[model samples]
Target: MGNLDGKVALVTGAGGMRGVGRATALKLAAQGADLAITDVRRDASDLPPAEVRQEWHSIDSVSDEVEALGRRCLPRYADLGISDEIQTLVRQVMEHYGRIDILINNARAVIGRDKVPVTDLEEEVWHHFLDINTTAVFLCTKFVGQEMVRQGSGGRIINIASNASKQASAMGAAYSASKFAVLGLTQASALDLAPHGITVNAVCPGPINTDRMSYWERSQADAAGVSLEEFRAQIVEQAGRATPLGRIAEAEDVANMVGFLVSDEANFITGQAYNVNGGLLFH
Candidate 1:
């Protein structure tokens, strides 16, 4: 049997076809965990106005794949930015799955274009970013922790943070700030949940080739007054130069870290943020 056999996992933001969330969900399923997937669907919600154009429908694809792997999959569309909605979603997961042994807080909000500095960032933008990135983690952990404690089985919370949380850059003010809070929150939650046998950790990823990067590339191309091809080359070159590994990360690399952290092998690892950025930031 797989390490995650008989386990149940809830992965947020698993609706993207080529992103970290989808990759994480697949990894869990392959390890023999029943999956509960949630994604922000296009509807009237407090989340940002636009949704990225996706070539493949990740929501259905991930669910089908999990079921084909001989594990159950419950795919739901929920906005991570909404607190009430998150509570309801967790309630549904408990009712359906009976228990949630693993929670992957993989949802994120982006200010695609219109890069604003922290000083000039609108309150609305900052609040929106925090709502999805940091606040959702708190809400999900609170409810899921309750279920885990009740089940008498310690659980795992693997938050998907980013290197931007520590590094400073233009046009990433809201994202960086919210992720910074996530790292701190992960440590605090790990300490508090230790008594309950629950472990909380975070995976800080650097420039992975996800749909999020595609959007950013287009935006950067426009910003730099260059063709999309040129813009992509420049971005790749810059990242390769900055990273000690001479390349940005792949989605599977981040997924591997998350898979290990959530497994029994990592029972002793908690309240720590592992950097999956290919030696981007060693300090």
Candidate 2:
């Protein structure tokens, strides 16, 4: 038997091949939690060139993996940027599972456009990041948190933040700002829900190995007039040399942190942003 044998978890952005969401879903399932996973069903227009598109069925594929671990899995498609969609998604999860004990807010929005300085950033782009990254967190926490409160059994809510939350980037003002807001949300929600046994926390990961990271690398490489291969090499060397731990992190590293946070062992922890960035930023 596992620590979460009877728990039900809802994870967002879980359809990527090498994502923190997929890893976290698997970790929670391995600990015996049934999963309700969501992903935006991407079409050709939503993606880049054929070569850039990841060839995997996001929700169905991950659901298969979760079920293989002997845990119930529900795969759903959701845009998540829309309030109505979020409400409906939460309602469906509660209806299917009876209760929600864990929520992992791991979905993010990234545009492949070149990274530009703050002054050159488009207004639409800024709102886009905030809408998907920051606002979605608020809406999900609001609705799902209400459900947890009504259930009266307490719960765990983990927001997937980034190293950007703590540090500013030269050409990443919008993205950094959104993540910083996520930290704020996590802390505030934690304080609000702590009295009822719920713990809210955020995890900040630095340069994890994921397909989304790869997409960013490609965009940055193009912006810097370097080939993708050269950019990849430079990033690996830079992260390895700069980080105190001598290497960047894998998706599993972040997932391990999420797993612990949702477990009973972390009952005393709340309202804190845990950094899993291999000592890149000390707070």
lDDT of each: 0.82, 0.88
What clash pairs does model 1 have?
none
Name the best candidate (by TM-score): 2
Candidate 2 per-residue lDDT, tens place, 125-203, comes to 8888898899999999999999999999999999999999999788888889999999999999999999889999999
Each candidate's TM vs. the true structure? 0.89, 0.92
Give the root-mean-square deviation of each candidate in angstroms.
3.3, 2.4
Residue 209, candidate 2: Cα error in Å is 1.0
Candidate 2 displacement at residue 57 in angstroms: 0.4
Alpha carbon lDDT at 227, candidate 1: 62
lDDT of 2 at 184: 95
Which digits, one per residue and each the tens of the lDDT, describe model 1 over residues 1-283?
1389889999998876667888899899999899999987643322222233333555777898778888899998888888889889999998898889999999887545325666787788788888988999999988888888888889999999988877867878888888999999999999888998999999989887654534455666878899655776677678878888988887889999998998878989998888898887864
